[model samples]
Target: MTSASGFLHSLPMRQLRGVGPALAEKLAKLGINTVEDLLFLLPRQYEDRSQITPFGALIPGMTTLAEGEVKLADIALGRRRALLVRLRDHTGGLTLRFYHFRQSQKESYRPGLRVRVFGEVRLGPLGPEMVHPEVEFLSEETASPESGLTATLTPIYPLVDGLTQRRLRELMARALPLLDQTDALVDVLPARSSGGWTLADALRYVHAPPLDSDRRRLLAGEHPAQQRLAFEELVAHQLSLLQRRQRQRQWPAPACTDSAQLSEQFLHQLPFQLTHGQQTVLHEIRHDLQQPTPMLRLVQGDVGSGKTVVAALAACPVLAAGYQVAIMAPTEILAEQHRQRFQSWFEPLGIPVGWLAGKVTGKARQTQLNSIASGECRLVTGTHALFQDSVQFARLGLVIIDEQHRFGVEQRLALTRRGLASGFAPHQLIMTATPIPRTLAMSAYGDLDTSVIQGLPPGRQPIQTVVLPATRRDDLITRIAHHVASGQQVYWVCTLIEDNEQIQAQAAEVAADLLRESLPHLAIGLIHGQLKAADKAAIMAAFASGQIAVLVATTVIEVGVDVPNASLMVIENPERLGLSQLHQLRGRVGRGSAASFCVLLYQTPLSGLGRERLQILRDSQDGFVIAEKDLSLRGPGEVLGTRQTGDISFRMADLLRDQHLLEPARVLAEHLMRDNARLEQALLQRWVAEKDHYATV
Candidate 1:
């Protein structure tokens, strides 16, 4: 109802005075295209420059505002040249060293000129010093007039090249009041939801708090104002995902209720029975499949909890409906495993299985593609190759994605589009072995209904974990020989494929060579990401068939690697990986009824965080518990593998710290969607960028 209501989100950074094209480009690098984005780019910390600290009272390691006359200015010639200017107050003296200075900049700090400085004081070789501190010319003498001090706690923001703190501060000062005059900062949430502060008041407090404001609370983001912003951001994200869910229902999907006979035959052929947990999850998937709308569901279970089996049964319904099914994996090895497993299960029931991947080249690749397009390959499994333009499906009814977080939004859209058969979209059943925390599952997968396999099958023994220093390498190798002599396989996981001094990780090739020399009678195999897909597949097969006594690999083997007889897992530099990754690597073993042990052969001088990560794995075998701890230590990006894998990154709300807001945000999002459509659209416009990706139709 006010002039300012819709302007902030639409206002460009260039609208601010002095922000030219070049300056706006720099801001764009920091994701600041709109005035609202700039406002939300809150300070990492703040400093108090309202009052000055006397040189005598300034202590090393403390940041303070101080002023004094320049005593001496000289160029110091050392290994690195530096311009050093000594300043003196009546009580004490300190030096300002600038390593990067132009001729004009160096000459500006002349002796006898008083200047105000703000920076951390550190004990230097000569005395206390401030390196490259912010320097403002005061006056020629103490008797002359000096500039006034900052009236409020100065906000310190993260910056890009060509953008300085002073420039950003001036822009904020100019633009903030523009919105205030028009009452633009309207509340999308109910009034009083933001810890009793209006959205405008919250932004003002966060951007420029009063001098007496709680510095500790502000620095730690514990203030009510910051919480207000965080809560709104969380709600916006929830609404965007829920909107995505609504769009999924808009697309017509193949309803698959005719799977009972086919699923029974597939189940009967299996040697093992489905665990109660698997059966429960399968029931949920079946109900979703019977819907005409696409099934958006994420199935989660701990490692070796029979998730793939549940997926197989889920596919039966789609297959029975006279349409095809496609299963996608993040890695070729995982995809191959699925292909073989599915062929073994389905080929007996008159269902043909097809495989497609980068490795399936020339005639083989074309044959597989033809089989898929010709309505012959009723079931197919592959890596991202399934998304290729050459690959097409006939009446594709269901799409199952394993390690769903490893694929990007575009890849998802591409595969879902391939199932555009006769005006109907394919149902999607996403699966993940990385146990997602309840709060995270609710937010990240809010677009999809979730069903988690409660626990591992009966009689599954917990993995025995042990932490050992790399100093025990020789002893561990000898133990490895003994383990291998007993006819059991072992996985020697190196963090690298080549020697990296910075990482201090032994390469898989080097480790394999060393292992071969130590145990001449045993067969050793090496695998890494650098290897061709065919080579990697060959090594994995050798290891699986017991031809390779020791399989040396990098973290490429972290996901969906199955080897039942591999009772021992020796991870080099286990400290380098997060708890979830380490847990996934551990899951590779302890897979069989035989007892399993995971040895964390960590290099010494491990950091506290690294040590804590290793300890968490050593103490507990629960993937969910380990994943929650990983989220806290590493944040959600790395936990979901999205930092390197996908576009699902959050701008403000941290899943670990603001988890308490998730359920409330979910509730509010649903209410807003039902009660007010205009507000829901506004919320999505403000927060989300990839709405097209969410529109799987």
Candidate 2:
């Protein structure tokens, strides 16, 4: 523990031996502001520098190391003058050419000096040669262990402008010795497993791997050193989630013990029976609701997997218990859909369902607010406006959040705070139709108990998907006209790659115009994010009632706009969208019993990833499969879309690749919290940084 107050942890990069202003500026671009940053900046790969190959054994186009005595040195006279050094080993001789050389470099390559050179070898006029090879001068003094005479590997790092591998290696060399004097690499995590390396040992091995190190494992991030770091990161995430869950449990929820009668009645009234998935999830929900501790559960189902029904079933018990329920949706359209569904289900049962949105204004909004405050509204659903400061829920018992990814943890917690009036927190059931990968489910929603509705309702038919070139627009239009003439509705989804809404709206407008021009007899409607809330609602209503044959809209209709009669989906430029999005859009059409078709009209010259994404959508209707593929192809950031919260941010661990460690990390985290609170706090401080400050308390 020599480096308890390690200089490497806090000392500025400028304090390093050779880091001047220019070099420091360049290093800053790579986030290397301190000596500790330099120490943690491990190598991307390594070169075998342990032994030099004989000049005769060097092969053309192979990067190798060779050592020889400099037999001749001269400046070659040509169109490009170069410093040429002829080096001879016992077996053969090779040439070293340096195009851009300094006077010092010229003086250093004197004849009769033994040198080690590393570079790609190529067949040359004089047998073989290396151009701009890395040259190291050897001394007549005996090779010493400290001088790396027996060291076999050289570190390669990702560099920025004005930074070279050689310079970074020299910097690491200067920084590594400081670790011996300081505790910069101290392991804060307990040694929970037998196989993992200590923090300091992992850092040392990763930064300067030996010749015998497994290069393949290092590159794949499967080495024991990398595994140690990954495990620590996973544990940090687990601890954050667990602490958050603990804080949530501190708040109590109204125990809904009499939910069985109303919940059974609500299910009995449904024309169809709940699927096994829904039944199982409801059982879990009932168990959570009975607990005095508030429920933090996530209901993840594929599109059209009856998530809304499950949500409604969960709400029945709370409503019957004389407590209010609030459902928050990401979009106004989605919120309205839930409101309509809930109204139909509850109004007959004498339970009032209330609606609140951004558009509800003046007297109507005040009336809704009054109803909620007076507790007349036993169940309420709306967009984010439900969390507005003016809105208050009387005896709020449960909060159901649909498409939870669209809302962050803070937003969810804001709703949870509303139920504090009863001296308890509300039970929260967050629902998302976008299937999450298993790793994300563990890392992102791990705090919550997860219930997944695996299968769709029995009566729904499978959707047939097709991919076509955008050049065949006329053919696609003809097919759409044919479907519309048969009294079937279609969705024309227009998407723009740019963030500009005006341009995106214009794209939808252009598509609408094209459809109107081609199919004059068919009624076409348009919608976009720029539209007024009322206008969007009106268009959706008309489309739902079969008044509009084709609805052209931006990605606004990607979620919660359920038009059962709309049996065909035409996604223009489908290649521009992610797999999850494409699947969601497709889900909009297949909701009805009539045979549905999803046309992915993509532009030609599609990138490999775009092609693969489209093909995946065509090949599988399973959202979970597409989600996993999307995570692998587009990465966790894009796959999670804009739902990224502070807890989900990963610096070293890849959820998709390092998923195997999540369970073990979670178990270890639980043990730490139970047996070693101080070590847990230290580990969170080291890895989660400032994010887990409250967990320490």
Query: TM-score: which candidate is best?
Result: 1
Which pairs of residues collide in candidate 2? 3-182, 3-183, 49-152, 50-152
lDDT by residue for model 2 over 1-697, one digit each (tens)?
2333244556889999999999999999987888877766766567777666899899999898788888888888888999889999898999999999986787887888888889999987888999999887888663332454447468788889778888998898787777665456546555656255777777777778877888898777788887887788789789888888898788777888753788878877899988999999998998898899898899999988999888898888888788899989999988888888899998888887899999999999999999999888889989989988899888999999988878776687678778986678899998988899988888878788988887989868799999999998999999988898888999999998897879999999999999999999989999999999989889999999889889999999998888889999999888877899899999998777799999989999898878878889989999999999998888777877665545486655778888889988999899988988767765665565434333311
lDDT of 1: 0.83
lDDT of model 2 at residue 533? 90
What is candidate 1's lDDT per residue for 569-624, written digit by digit as tens? 99998877778988989899977777888999999888897888888898898899
Q: Pairing residues by index, what is the TM-score of model 1?
A: 0.92
**Where does candidate 1 stray beyond 4 Å?**
1-37, 56-58, 71-74, 139-146, 178-182, 496-506, 605-611, 644-651, 689-691
